[model samples]
Target chain A: MDVFLQTLVAGILKGGLYALIGIGMTLIMGVMGIINLAHGQLMMVAMYITYVLHLAGVDPYISLFVAMPALFLLGCLIQRFLLNPLLKVDTILPENQVLMTVGIGMVLTEIIRFIFKSDYKSVSTGYSNATFFLGNISFSIALGISFIIAIAFTVAMFFFLIKTDIGRSIRATAQDKDAAVLMGVNTGRITIITFGLGSGLVAAAGCLLAPVYYVFPDIGGPFTARAFIITILGGLGSTVGAIFGGVTLGLAESFGATYISMDYENIIGMTIFVLVLLFLPGGFKRLTKI
Target chain B: MLKVDAIDVFYGDLQVLWGSSFEVREKEIVVLVGANGAGKSTTLKTISGLLRPKAGTIVFDGVRLDRLPADRIIGHGVVHVPEARRLFREMSVEENMVMGSLAPEARKKRRETLAWVYELFPRMKERRKQAAGTLSGGEQQMCAIGRGLMALPRLLMFDEPSLGLAPILVEDVFNIVKRINKEGVTVLLVEQNVRQTLALCDRAYVLENGSVVLQGTGKELLADPHVKEAYLGL
Candidate 1:
């Protein structure tokens, strides 16, 4: 029972950070109706930013603010210059925008490889190995802090989406672009902002993971696959579903690792994805509506 | 004041509007009544800047609306209430209304405008907290109109406002349009319900296969021999 409880706590903590990455990708997907394949590459960029800043004596947490806004502007430029222009082009495939993201992911990865030399790098603070004990379980202090900060950011995001005018416009644009335009929303501007918001969010998750995880150009591929799995499991374009999807994936992986084999963890995730696709086709969105 | 001058619109390689032109002066409830696929919706969509004309201009109060994007046209006080009541499905009724009040001045009077909208559509007020997708078709139409009103539009356009509603709800929609028209907002309505909309509108234009085949006052078109046989089924 103690082992089970310990696994549950750790899974939830890890899940919180996963939710941050999922939310960003989901936001971009929701508004644009296209999978942003470069999502994890964007996060990888932020991790490198954090890694560089950490070497300069900046805390990973402090560098979060800097990485987030920086990635936001980058995201805005990418959407405005790259993605939005695709809407006017008479491409052979409607999925040209989606394929463009794959190109973007490759470019981003190659650029990082050129700069960082394909080396595995990790950031370690003084408290990297610190732990806190409660009852019969122990929690890593850094993971706990990351979890709390992730939760804080999640709550802030919900508030922004629900209460702010720009947030409302984003939702409106996501729901129906034509209606949003008729309602006087600058949907073009909203799309750019939403992409920025999505990038900024993933940057937060990247910074949070930098202290405990390895940073490399190729790490993005696996995380990108993981992000999409979570998105599919939760339901495409559902932010609330992303939280449930992230936590479910987290718990499944942790339990699979502890009970079965470490190799089976990803297999277990794939099983969950198949089950979700078969049984709950709309993801949790069909059940939760919002 | 709005002027659409010999505009030609297309959907990809197919032309949908061929030299379609019309005018709506301030405070007039103008109606464009046509058969299915007669380009009524396309005309409204063009006027609202959703679709740009290939070789003509849409000038509203001397500003070239065809030169602007759909979103920018809204800022110029031209709001298009789209067909099928395209309310933000995940958002609440009130949130949908709030989305409409995006202009600076509209944002300031959002509270008052919301109150007025709710007053006009009490059904919307009762379900203000409900997600818009869950509403019935008639209720959705009302919510769509209410949302359009929240924009405080100078020239409000409705595309098939009574498309899929019960007879009584259709009457309610016409009455709402009439009531709003009396309150100093010019309206351009697209509808297939030829008889009632002609009765309700100040002036009517008949569109046939992407061209304006007839134009006159509501009573004049209602009595025209060609309109009587082709549309009113009289």
Candidate 2:
């Protein structure tokens, strides 16, 4: 029973960080109606920024202040110069924009590879490996801190979306673009800001994970796949759905790692993803209206 | 207050509107009536800057609007209440209303505008907390109009406001439109219900196959032989 509870606690804590990552991807997906395939690549860039700052004797947590805003600017540039121009392109297949993101992912990965190389760099800090025991269960202090930060950010994000005018404009743009236009929402500017916000959020997740995980150019590929899976498992644009999707994925992966073969961790996630696709096609969005 | 002079619009390769020109004087309720695919909605969209004109110009109160973006057009006090009640489904009705008044000028008067809108559509007030998606069809239409009113438009446009509603509710929506016009807001309405719209409007333009084929006072058009033959089926 203690073993089970230990795994559950581990899953929930990890899930918090996953929710942060998923929220970023989902918000972009919701507002833009296109997947930022470079989402994890952007996170990888943030992680590298944190890593470089760490080399300069800055703690990873402190590096967040730099990494997040840098990534936000980068994301805004991508939207302004790269993605927003596609709106006028009159492409036969709308998927061309999505393909552009995939290309962007490749370019970002290669650029980071050129700069940081393929060597796996560890962001080991004083507290990275520290843990505390609660009865027979143990929790990593870093993971606990990240979980709290993630929850705080998630709560703050909800507040921003609920209470602010810009947030309402974003939601309005996502819901019915024509109505938003009629209401005087500058959707072009909204898209740029939304992309920036999404990048900043994913950057936060990247910084949170940097101390607990290794930084490598290739690390982004797997997390990119995971981000899309979380988006699909949730709903295309549902924030609440992304949270549930992240938690469900984290729990499934944790349980699979503990009981099933360690090699089958991805397979377990894939199986659940397939099941949800088959049975609950719309994901948690259909269940939770918001 | 508004002038659309010989505007030609195309959707990609296909031309949807050809030299469509009309005018809406301040405080007049003008209707654009036509069958499906006749470019009634396209006219509204073009005027609102959703689609740019290939030729001619759209001038509102002496400033050209054809070159502006959709959102910027709204800043000039033109608000469109679109077809099918495109309310934000997940947002509460109140929130949806709140979205209409997001611009700085409109935001300043949000409190008074909201109160006035609530008085105009009491159903919206009663169900302001509910998700807009859950409202009955007519109530959703009223809520959409209420949202448009929240924008404090100098010239308000409605596209197919009575689509997909019961016959009884159709008259109610039309009466609301007339009431709104009576309260001193200029209106540009698009509709397929020729008989009722012609009677309710002060003036109207008849569109057929993307061209403004006819125009006059509502009673004049109602009495025209061509209109009676083609649209009224007299």
Candidate 3:
């Protein structure tokens, strides 16, 4: 029972960071109706940024503000210059956009490899290995701080979507493009802004993970797969569902790593993904109706 | 006032409107009556800047609207309540209305306009917190129209506002349109419900095969022998 409780606590903490990453991907998916294959690459870029800042004596947590806004601008540029132009292209398959993102992921990986030479890099602060105990469960200090920050960001995002004017416009565009236009929403601009917001959120996750996870050029590929699974399990465009999906994946991975062979960690995630696809086709969003 | 002058609109190689021309004078209830595939909806879309005209221009008030984008057109007070309601399904009825007032000009007056819209359709007020997709068809139509009113439109256009409603609900919808027009908003309505729309509108235009074939006062067109044969089934 103690072991089980410990695993659960660790899973929930890791899940909070996963939720941040999933939210970014889901936001881009909801507004643009395209899977961003380069999403993990964007986070990888932020991790590198955080690592460099840490080497320069800046704290990893403080690097978040710099990494977020920088990635936000980068995201806007990609959407405006790369993605928006494709809307007018005459293509046989609409999957051209998805393919473009895959190419983008490759390009980003190669560029980072050229700069960093594929070395596994990590940022280590004083609290990176520090732990605290609550009854029988121990929690890593860094992960606990990350979890609290993630919850704060999620609550902030909810208020933004529900209370603000531009946030409502984003929801409107996701619902119906034509109706959004009729309602005076500048949808093209909204797409650019949504992409930026998505990137910023993922950048936050990357900064939070920098001290815990190794950063490398090719690290994006596995994280991309994980993000995709979370989005699919949560229902493609539902934000609330993404949170639930992330937590479920985190718990599954945690339990699998402990009870089963550690080598099967990813396999466990894949198995859950397949089962969810077969049984809950619409994902948790269908059940929650959000 | 709105003017569509000899516009030709196309979807790729297929032309939907050829040399289509019409006008809606200030504060007038103007109806464009035609069958499916007659380009009635296409005309509304063109005026709203959803589809650009291949050749020709659209003028709303004194401003040329043909070059403006779909979103910019709404800022000029030309609101198109599109076919099928097209309510944001996941959003609440109030949120849908709030979206309608997103433009800079409309945003300042949103509160007063929202109050007026709720007065026009009290049913919408009761369902304000409900998701628009869950509403009945008649209630959805009411919400759609209420949303348009929230934009503070000087020229309000409706595309088949009563398409799928029962007869009694259709009557209620038309009555609301009439009430809206009486409140000083110019209306350009597209409908296949010929007799009733003609009875309510001040002037009417008959469209066939993407072109305007006839135009006159509502009473004049209602009495025309050709209209009676082709449309009224007399």
Candidate 4:
């Protein structure tokens, strides 16, 4: 029983990292109506940045401050130059966008591979293996920190989307770009900023994940797939839904590993995804359509 | 004052506005009445900076607007409330209204304008927390107009504001337009409902095949033989 509870705690902690990555994906996809296959690659790049910073003796946590804004600016530039033209183009066909983003992802991963090979790299902090106890449950300090930071990032994103002037523009543009422009929203600027913010969150996620997972140029593929599942399950563009879906996925994986063979984890996750696709018809239909 | 001078616009190779011209004096409610595909909305769009004129210029308060982008045109106090009540559906009523003030002055006086908007549409205030998608047709129209008001525009243009509205609701909405105009905002209203629009407008322009064929005071245009025979169903 104690071992089962321990696995549960670990799973939930890991779920935090998943939620962090998925939230970034959801924000970009939900607002821009483009499924960024390059998202995972962006995360991988951030992970590499964190890894390099750690290798140079900077703490991974401190590297977040450096990585986020850099990634954000990169995202903004990409949106302003590359994606803004596509805004005039149609996005109803998901395949066209998927192909475009897949190409971008490939280019990004290859660039990183050309510079930093495909070898695994990880950030080793001083408290990498540190833990804390809450009653009978043992919590890894690193995981707890990631979870707290993840929630904080999500909260900040929510406030931005809801409270500030620019945030309102993002939401307005997401709903209807034509209407947003009609309402005097500089959609070009909004798209650039939103893309930057989304990419920045991915950077933060990568930094948090570096200390917990083995990082490499190709590491983002699995995380991206996991994010795809979580975003769909939670309803796309829903910040709160991403966190809940992540925790649920984490618990499921833990239970599947314990009761069944650990090798069946992937199978279990895919099965749930298939079931959701079949049964839900539309995930979170109550959500107001933009 | 606004002047849309002999502007020609096209959708691909097909011409939508051919030498369309009209003028709205300051604080006047000017109505453009036309049949389907007559380019009434297109004229409004051209003047509001959504579509540029291929041949002519839109002059608002003596400043030419052909070079400005749609959002930038709002700085000159020209705002378009598009057809179909294009409120941001996923956001709350308050959020949608807040977005209306995305223009510089609106952003600066956000608090004052927001309170005024809620006062203008009390129903919106009641459902301030509700998602705009859930609002009824009339309520959505109110939100759209309220949003345009938030911009503090000098010239507020409405496109087909009466579309899809009930008869009673249409009267209420037109009354609101008159009220908004009386509040010292110049209004350029585009409508399919010729009779009611003529009833409220200070002056009227009749558009046909993308050009203004008739222009006069509201009563003068209403009394014209062609307008009486074709539009008033008299």
lDDT: which candidate is best? 3
| Per-model lDDT | 0.91, 0.91, 0.93, 0.84
Q: Which lDDT tens digits does candidate 1 get at residues A1-290? A: 98898989888998998899899889998899998999999999999999999999999999999999999999999999999999989868999989999999999999999988998998999888889899989998999999999999999999999999999988888888887887777888999999999999999999999998899999888788778888987789989999988888888888888888988977888888899899999988888876
Indicate the worst ten consecutive residues by lDDT in candidate 2 chain A: A88-97
* True-structure Cα RMSD, model 3: 0.8
DockQ, every prediction: 0.82, 0.79, 0.91, 0.80
Which pairs of residues collide in candidate 4? none
Best by TM-score: 3
Docking class of 1: high
Q: What is the DockQ of candidate 1?
A: 0.82
lDDT of 3 by residue, B1-234 (tens): 788999999999999899999999999999999888999999999999889998998998789999898889988989999999999999999999999898888899999999988888888999999999999999999999999999898999999999999999999999999998899999999999999999999999999999999999999999999999989999
lDDT tens readout by residue for model 1, B1-234:
999899999998999999988999989999998999999999988888788899888999999998887777777888899999898998999998998888887889999999999998899999999999999999999898888888889999999988889999899889999999999999999999999999889998999999999999999999999999999787
Q: Largest DockQ belongs to which candidate? A: 3
B170: Cα error in model 1, Å: 1.0
Q: What is the lDDT of candidate 1?
A: 0.91
Model 4: chain A TM-score against the true structure: 0.91
Every model's TM-score on chain B: 0.98, 0.98, 0.99, 0.98
Of the pair 2 and 4, which is ahead by DockQ? 4
Error of 3 at A120 (Å): 0.9
Could you tell me the lDDT of residue B203 within candidate 4? Answer: 97
What value does the lDDT take at residue B179 in candidate 2? Answer: 91
Candidate 2 collision pairs: none
Candidate 4: tens digits of C-alpha lDDT, residues A21-63? 7777777876788777788788888888898899899988899
